[model samples]
Target chain A: MKNAERKRWCLEHAGEPLTPEDEAYLKEHPEVRLEVERLALMAKLMSLKNHEEPAPHLETRCIARVQERIQSRRERGWLYRLEDALTLNSAPVWAAAAALAVLGAGLWVTLHTPPDAGVAAVQEADPGMPPVSLAAVGDVQPSVVQTSPAVDVASADREIPLNEKPILFLRMESNQLPHNSDQLIYGNGGTMPVRFDY
Target chain B: MIDPHPPDAAGQAEEVTDQELVARAQGGDLEAYNELIRRHHRKIYAMVYNMTSNKEDAEDLTQDIFYKAYSVLNKFKGDASFYTWIYRIAVNRTINYVKRRNKRAGLSLDDVDLGIERDPAFLELSARESPFRECTLTELQEKLNKALMTLSEKHRTVVVLHDIQGIPHDEIAKLLNVSSGTVRSRLFYARKALQVELSEYAP
Candidate 1:
């Protein structure tokens, strides 16, 4: 064997006797034998070094520290989970805020807009009043006035007055009055008379 | 009424397999883990002590290693033996710690144990015709530790693991995450370096 390999083998197996190949190599190269012996001695010395005794409380202290770590982790479990859930990539918080904003806007629109405005507009468009000519009032018989749906023909027939100046009878119901006055009007352009039906 | 068990109960407890204890410890059994600590703490402390040569640092590092091992016990797959896994942790932690310590200060040797003179190897060496026999045990230990500190961290680790700790090359390779050939080469060079450093003591 080569001298370097022989020395390495000797150092590696310090307690064992050299093989015939190593003995032959060492005999041929006595210079490397001293080096091998020194390494063997060093290894023996290193092995003989005493094993140091650790502190008596080392195990207890370690166990206590580990327990403390485990307990602290348990106590902060929810906070850590919450933090993980609210990370920027998750988007739960932003999604919830957006949903709340949409619901609030819907509630505001539902509260402020009147529900009966459409019905009021339809009523104003077709008020159920029939066409009546002032000149034909005298010529109109009760039967002709009865054909008008909005006139309340029976009430109109009893109130019609025949005159050369053609009086128009406009009936105002108590609920329809803007100023809480229930009155009928019968008159010409400038001079008018207010007649209270009640 | 308290029932008395045999006094050898602690001795029997020490005989439990590392795998059994590891299983129990993984299930949150504190006693099982403490038993493991009792069994292996000495060897682990010795390994770190040899690397650092400082008893206080070795004690603190040993505690830190056990605490870290317990914290990550669940991650340990049964592929390696429990002792091997713990050994890996102890070695790696000590290596990192030594690196950080090296940056701050030079290596220092603690007082040698008085019992070293009684060791069989020391007696055999003292009987030889060498300068090692001339110095006192304390002086020899200090010189050996100083020589060890002179080596690079990688070389020192290989030597400690293979030569001092008597770990097999294959096992040392696994712990170091290197091939067995690399471990052998490193061990060879490390021993060669030590032989050169301690040549005066050679016969």
Candidate 2:
């Protein structure tokens, strides 16, 4: 073996006896032997360094932690499973990009679109129709009220006339009304001034 | 708590191959998984301790390594022995950890075990009239660990695996994902660096 190769082999196998061929090569070049001895001593000292036993609690702690992790993963439902699947190497970059794009577009539409656009669309579709207020459905013009003749006369008879103008009261229970009375206007022109009595 | 498995079955469990344990673990046997941890935690801890030179970090990293291995048990293809597979995870995780730790702060050494004084190699070295004898084995261990930290992570890893841990070059190559030639070259350079660093204690 060449000197450099022999030296490398000797350093690599520092504690081990040199092979016959390498030994002959080293004998031929005694300078490499000194280098080999130095490397061996270094390896010996490095090996002599104390082995650090982990704390006695390490195994139990590790097992407990691992068990906790496994339990947590088991408890996680499909959302985490989906996340794992999406994070897998098999999940292509385009799929993630597409998902992000869809989310971003949905958010953009939500933030930019006016909250009352649906109401405006309904009015635009029939410009002659009056806007119906859910809170005051009884206050709708008689003309709009005429569109729906199905209003039960008995309920209307008991209606408290909060405002005059031949009010047609639709007495609905307070719980029946939308949580946000301000946003609960019906789109159709068949408006009735609603009276909610708890 | 009653023993679910018979005594013979428990004996069989002890004798089961790693592949069998892995299969059982994959099938939701917590005991099998714990057995694997019991089998390999020390070696893994030692490897991490050597690389990081901090006991607390080593303990944390060892736990993390096992947790990661357990989490991804399904991904193991059975191509490599569980030992090799776990070692791969450990080596990779530790390398990344060492890199991140290097950016944050310098390496820190733990107090060397008092057992080093009774070690045969340590006794032999301390017997000689050398500068290293002036200090105790624990001090020598501290100095060695500090010197080890001076080498680059790559060099330190090779030295720790090959020289200290006594892993063969081929296995070191497999663990580090490098060629045997690269392992040898790294060992050579690492040893040379360590030699110069510890020249004061040279006999």
Candidate 3:
């Protein structure tokens, strides 16, 4: 190649492994040789000038960051393990069987419970029953249930409408209790007798 | 006749193998990963700092590169050296970052953040030397960087990789996923551009 072409080739291949032909051309052509030498020198100068060490704190920061990522990966690994264990192929069929057992027990309890008379009374009341005070509406028969003046004072802070019927309260165990018992509480406004120790 | 056996052990020991370190790292050796970083961090930083021209962004990008490498350690097949793989990641990320910034900033290639006149290191160099103080090499470097900015990212990256980092063209091609011919042509144009820009630096 001519000088200009050889110089162009040298620039093009600045950091490449030189072919024997290009090496021979540079040996033969003084101008191409000078250009090659200058390019190498310039490359070295630029590399030296721009060769920067990473920031002093980068190693520590990178280690900390990598450790943080590793910790996250560990946490994620546990989740993945859980996923694998819970997958259809990996999980035992016993879990489904256990779920069926609990559901069956729930259904059994729901079917066996007898209906309450107070509940049936409230539920199937002669719609014509006289509207009683919020505190006086209860399990006692209308003939025996007296509206004492003292009862109104205790629950007076709440507005208990005269027309409201007392609702039966269920205990924590889901058993129905009369609203008047101290253990069971009348909510909104109906009273019924329910007895239990606090 | 068999070719004379190359000196294997000492030649191999002279340079740290990224594959070995990566395999060890994947096997849960944290120190191996640290060694990997120690071996490659400077080159990675040089690439980032040249692209960013700011230490802060360079440091952040360097961290991102290694963090990404660490996260994907299991996926690294030995087709490329870990150096080439991470270098490609760094370059691709930087190019994407610049592209995204260009989209938002509406800035052209000529307007990359090559930093300002008062960068402390360059300024310190300026203050200490008489000739450099008279007409600072930092100023000259800035001028060169500005000229570099005028080139497309592809060409500028070629110059930065081949010229500034002294990385070989074949390895650059591997990292850039370009033909060696393409590397050669781009390098020619990049050097020509740089020479015209840096002519004053030559005696």
Candidate 4:
């Protein structure tokens, strides 16, 4: 038979039952019969050639490796979860706190009051005569300290500054102010004594 | 027909399926998996060695095949025997290794050590054939093994599994991850190629 014809026949019957005609043909054809015998021989030889015993320690090694993998998973599971939770939620909270602190400090400086740089300069330039305490320096006479409270002014004299824009200084005698122990100087006709504690 | 026997009957038994063993190994059951490795390691090693033509590489590739099998054990289902699944892994890995080796060493499948000359089976093939008795055993065996190795990997594997290991076409299809038709085609071509290669020595 031609090579193509033989190949087609072999392929057609490879896993299936051979037709009686094809079987008889194979039995009669010396070349085809020899090849079939050779194939069967080759199969047996290949089987014998490749039957090696596997590594004796292969089983032990595989088991040990698997155990190690499981142990690692157990150890890392909680840590990974904690890391993920921290990553997902905690970063924004810290960021917001920092942002709020920055905002509050900015608002205090802008809306409520500015630092008294001007008052500090004035105090530094002044000489003698006990630089006029804002309490005594106010439009009200320092004598008003006596009429305002039971405590005398001389015993409780202290200086304080008020008004952030064009800064004012203050001094007051000991007085039982409702809000503050140190009295703050008030302008004429003002009832409240803004206490200066320091 | 030869009767099929269990590969081992004396050992302490493992109760899990191969897929279950792989799943347990994936989930951390080393002992369960070692049973799987012990069962199929030789067949995997043989398939790799035959294709690569080197013992050390075959050993390394065998190790790698099992490692790959272990890592992906969770993906295994019971659709095929563990033997077929690992056989596919062995064949694919060996083919890839051959391709890489070909690129690096500038060698082809013809260069591998096939041990055909040392084989004792030649005495049986030339038996009672009416002529050609004077040919040296080494010469005939070398010619045969060389012819076998020269076959393409696709054909070689089918021949090895079916002709050599006596695996059935359906089993081969499962191992190669192809249809029985494909296996049949490959076997036919492989056998034809071997016959052509060996035709000069025939009576």
Candidate 5:
């Protein structure tokens, strides 16, 4: 039999009657005898269970301590509860949640906040520039825009300094964004609000 | 008003299960929790004491573990037996404490030697004419405790639980969260090391 199997058998049958086969195995592996002797000593030690009989009233004292802790826990219950709420046991989970919230807010602001930086600066820098009405574009016919054979880039570009441009005010109440993505008709460059004729 | 000390009905009624007591305790029943403590405190205390070899540390730790179990009783899902749950807590916390303290002054086997004179099992061995028939036996017991101290906490824990505490190998496996084979292997190695260390006091 293997050493482990022999050890297992000897342990299982320690201090009990052994079979003839087991006797033959132990006789052959004399080294396992010390293991069996140690087993006997352990059994003797096991019999002395009360050797460590806890100091009298250990249970009563421990229970008293538990009650004290529970009482204290109750007395400062709110602070204990607040600590529990803020205790970051799962740091990664809270970190991921916080990161996702910040990312979502950034995306919302980017997608919803109007591109008003240039317009705001233009108004703030030159408060006297007359607010141009978007309705004025209605008077300039579309044909006039089409009939201009080739636009003079220098004149359009020189008419306004990059920092000093007129602001156009348009009023609409739809939460739905208008599909005015055709930038050629309504493009604004930096502070300059491109004129529209339509 | 709740009874400060409930009757020992749990002990008298064999059918009163730990699960039932746990359920009651979960509903803010302190009396039921007291019964649970009555049933398991000694075993928990002994396990901690054996691991730490310090009675004061064991006392404090046992109280802490019981109170911890009470504080977190609501989280007990009742899938595993409460004994297994509490034993696991006791073993883990004791092992952690042992590793942190990393010192030894244990078990005072000297006390065991003095206590076992009246024990029938030791009497059987004492009946034999042995070398220490005239000795104080304190040195021998001290040697034994020192030998036990030589073992790593993991090895000593197996010996303490299985041999001294009379816990079975399978239950120990569950409590230590290890395999049965691992438990047996550890016990075998631990017993062998201890025997070799104190061979002069051999049975």
Candidate 6:
């Protein structure tokens, strides 16, 4: 409670107490004591804040509870630990790498294994002729070569970065082509090879 | 007379830096973890207790907050000191618990420290002609807590953090995911409402 401007300043900054100059000003201008009472209340509240304490041995009890929890966590099955690790860290790099590895292994097993597990024979390609799409020719239907020589360039070593990339060629006479382009189950196109990497 | 307390491992670990304690705790040293808890649990408890205005809820929540900090200790990057980090955890969880409950329970306040009688602020206020001058410490504590419980959890939290616990508004804003302006405004309004509420107890 001082000059209007100074009183206003003290009121606005309630968190802190008044300056000594302002106390002198307030004593001289006792009429504005109403304004200074608010600061007194704020100081009272600050005292309340400082004087309160929680129960004794709070940390000791809290540590006990935390210990019990950690023990239970340790006793949890591996699945719980896995979830704990996943949530505890931000997309851990090892986790990401493990997920990719699992997917890669799953895909490798899927591609290498034949469509029909009953198809006991692993597919083979004659070095002289084009390879068939093993995946496309799901059930290896034995067929008669209706025409003279060969057909679509079936497969090649496309994935391998070899110095002289090996290419397999199949040359069947034009009459032996499937009656409709859509009828060629394994052929990628009427003229193009049905490439196989597996 | 027999010694009431034996030698304690944490007594030794207490001398270690928070950085060392955190590193050891991360490396599966449990005593180091307990020492870290010892270092901070009072402030955390006081914070939650004031916000909830109930001893039991404060106890439960404080325990849960520490357990949470331990469970997720690996995530602590030391980007902030352990004190700030745990305060962040305590503030966030208590706010959430307060909201979820959506109401205050009976105040199970602790005894006002005996030192409050001799506190300069208490002496100064009691000396002045004010509402608190004639009230006993217990009566003042109850009225204060009751008034505090009247505030919205957000406002109460800001007051508890900034006014009571002495945390900076910037830290409170970070904890609440709001701007420093919001903390200030909430505190201003909260203190205003409280002044009115408690002074209603005046003789």
* CAPRI quality band, candidate 5: incorrect
User: Which pairs of residues collide in model 6?
Assistant: A150-A171, A150-A172, A151-A170, A151-A171, A151-A172
By lDDT, the best candidate is 2
Off by over 4 Å in 6: A1-10, A17-33, A36-40, A78-198, B1-14, B102-104, B200-203
Listed per prediction, chain B TM-scores read: 0.85, 0.85, 0.69, 0.71, 0.80, 0.88
Q: What is candidate 3's lDDT per residue for B122-161, written digit by digit as tens?
A: 4544454334456544455566556566667788787788
Tens-place lDDT per residue, model 1, B103-179, is 43544555556677777888888888888767876677777777787788899998788767778778888888899
Candidate achieving the largest TM-score: 2
DockQ-based class of model 4: incorrect
Query: If ranked by lDDT, best first, what sequence of candidates would result?
Result: 2, 6, 1, 5, 3, 4
Q: Is candidate 3 or candidate 4 better by DockQ?
A: 3
Could you give candidate 4's per-residue lDDT for residues A83-132 as a string of tens digits?
53353334565687789999999987767543333333345555322333
The parts of candidate 3 lying over 4 Å away from their true place are A1-7, A10-45, A73-198, B1-20, B29-31, B103-134
Q: Any runs in candidate 2 off by more than 4 Å, and if so which?
A: A78-198, B1-14, B103-115
Look at candidate 4 and tell me the lDDT of residue A20. 75
List model 1 lDDT by residue over A30-62, tens digit each: 766665666677777677665333556765675
Question: Which consecutive 10 residues in model 1 chain A have the weakest lDDT in total?
Answer: A189-198
Consecutive 10-residue window with the lowest summed lDDT within model 3 chain B: B1-10
lDDT of 1 at A28: 81
Candidate 3 per-residue lDDT over residues A20-63, each given as its tens digit: 98888878877766666555544544553452344567767766
Clashes of each: 0, 8, 4, 12, 0, 5
The lDDT of each candidate is: 0.65, 0.71, 0.59, 0.56, 0.64, 0.67
Write model 2 residue lDDT over A157-193, tens digit each, in one string. 2244323323333322322446344233333433333
Model 3: per-residue Cα lDDT at residue B37? 74
Q: Write the per-residue lDDT of candidate 6 for residues A15-82, one digit (tens) a residue.
A: 46668877777688775455456644664565475677677767678888989878878888676667
- The TM-scores of all predictions, comma-separated, are 0.61, 0.66, 0.51, 0.51, 0.63, 0.62
DockQ of each: 0.19, 0.33, 0.11, 0.10, 0.21, 0.29
